[model samples]
Target: MSSSLRNRLAAVVMAVAAGLLGCTPASEPGASSEPAKPHRVLNTTAQPEDTIRVRGDHTERLQAFLRLRYGDKAALDAPWKDAWEDTEVEALRPVTRRVCARDTATADGQEQTLLAVCQTLDDAATVEPGRVDLYVLRVGTDEEKTNRGGFFAQLPADDPLLVMAQRLQGQYGRHGSPGTVQIAQLGPQRRAFQISHEEHRRGHRRVWRSYIAEHNHRLRDVARYRDHLDNLALHGCDGNPADCGEGVFAVDFNTTVGDSNAVEGYWPLTVRASGHDCTGPATAFYHLIFDARQRAYPVPDDLQRDGCADS
Candidate 1:
């Protein structure tokens, strides 16, 4: 072999050796080559993650769970901010503590889900791995189903926790929150959702109770704007005679990461409101910032403001 070729081969072998050695931390003091992984890591091989491709809403809710802080962890402190609509979320685990599956009946038919009780653990974990519970939700598809209506919930008798997660996911994801109560009258919350029954299902009533315990989160923001700019005066017909009503706030559904097939997917929520008094225009946009260890979806109070100057 030529000396030049031998030198090139030696360089390639050295590069491979360096990469292999860098897989773990160095014995000497220097930054480790390992990258920072986010909290809510999913799909462990020791205890495999669920394979169920749940209804769109459930998937979205799961994503909402993934983004929030798990506690006062310095590492996981991330909040939603301005004009980040195209922000891409890593497909991190939804902090699932426990997952249970069950069946429920409706006028239209029956539906099933793996009621995963989720929590935020550091990339390492907050609790002992043995202490954490486990269940696998292996989902089935249309082609595999021999019968119609897909999969139906067939959990162990009286496993109320699974039942409850099924109920809440169905109710909230189905009807949404209280201010905008969903009428039970709406059939199947719109359209068809099917599940497979071939898999043996189990329920842990404890999981449902835990899910409910952390589910009640509220977001509130107090913004009082007074613009005496001739037209933008507070409740004043003097500055701008033709005054519109109070600024309108509406919830905007984030389509990204939501189930592409379903219209409304999950609750990584955003609030949009536009206000003006003729001098110009102002808007407040809010998205629930997930803190560590949140269970239920919280309407966000943190509002990012956008305004057009009168000057």
Candidate 2:
């Protein structure tokens, strides 16, 4: 089936699994007295030089960089101001005038993304072969405009990353386009960068939990629960409408290799699909194998969750 269909299925299935595997309920009754006090600041920023390098001048540095910093802002803002201090010189290969998907329009299921690769500043080049193939940047409308000064570059509709983002956004009922884009090398390792669902969820859950804990009890005690509910309901995903669906989805980064850049890695991608009613949860599963090369590792047999047989 199509990748979008596969992703939706995977998300639904995983969401269910995520709910079952480790979700601590809303902490009703004396269940822990208080839901961990909301933890105030549950920091999710990755440190600079958090490199996960593979073959073909590929490193996770850029993706990690964007995730920890610019994941919430536009390309120009690049919130992780301090990371540059420790980053190696090669990883600083910044590009100019790349378009970024807008923030406000993204909430209605639209997706803003950045797809880039590392190359030498001295020589023009494309993303190194076998480097990460896809990356996404998700943000909110009201969030500050981070692009301090740079021309935005739009992506051709055929571009893989852009196509996928557009499709997914349509599924959720929104529209957007790329903002600014660029790539850098922090030393010898080349890196590709983009925003991801895991990063967004990290931010969303932290904020949601804090808001609920702080006001839920107060509202109930004062018989102002409806007031609180109305106020909260007005604010949607990063300010989108309530029906815009949850601001959570998945992103996959694949790789392609050239003959000259042979490295040890498998290129195996497994996708499963299932459906559910609109009111019920949707579910699917995805398991991929990769070689040391960080490329897709092929598998001999189609693997599925063991023990579930056809009726």
Per-candidate TM-score against the hidden true structure: 0.20, 0.17
RMSD of each: 20.4, 28.0
* Whole-model lDDT, model 2: 0.24
Clash totals, every prediction: 12, 37
TM-score for candidate 1, residues paired by index:
0.20
Give the per-residue lDDT of model 2 (tens digit) for 28-77.
Answer: 66566543321111121221221112212112333443443334332333
lDDT of each: 0.27, 0.24
Which candidate ranks first by lDDT, i.e. highest?
1
List the lowest-lDDT window of 10 residues for candidate 2.
220-229
Q: Which ten residues in a row have the lowest lDDT in candidate 1?
A: 200-209
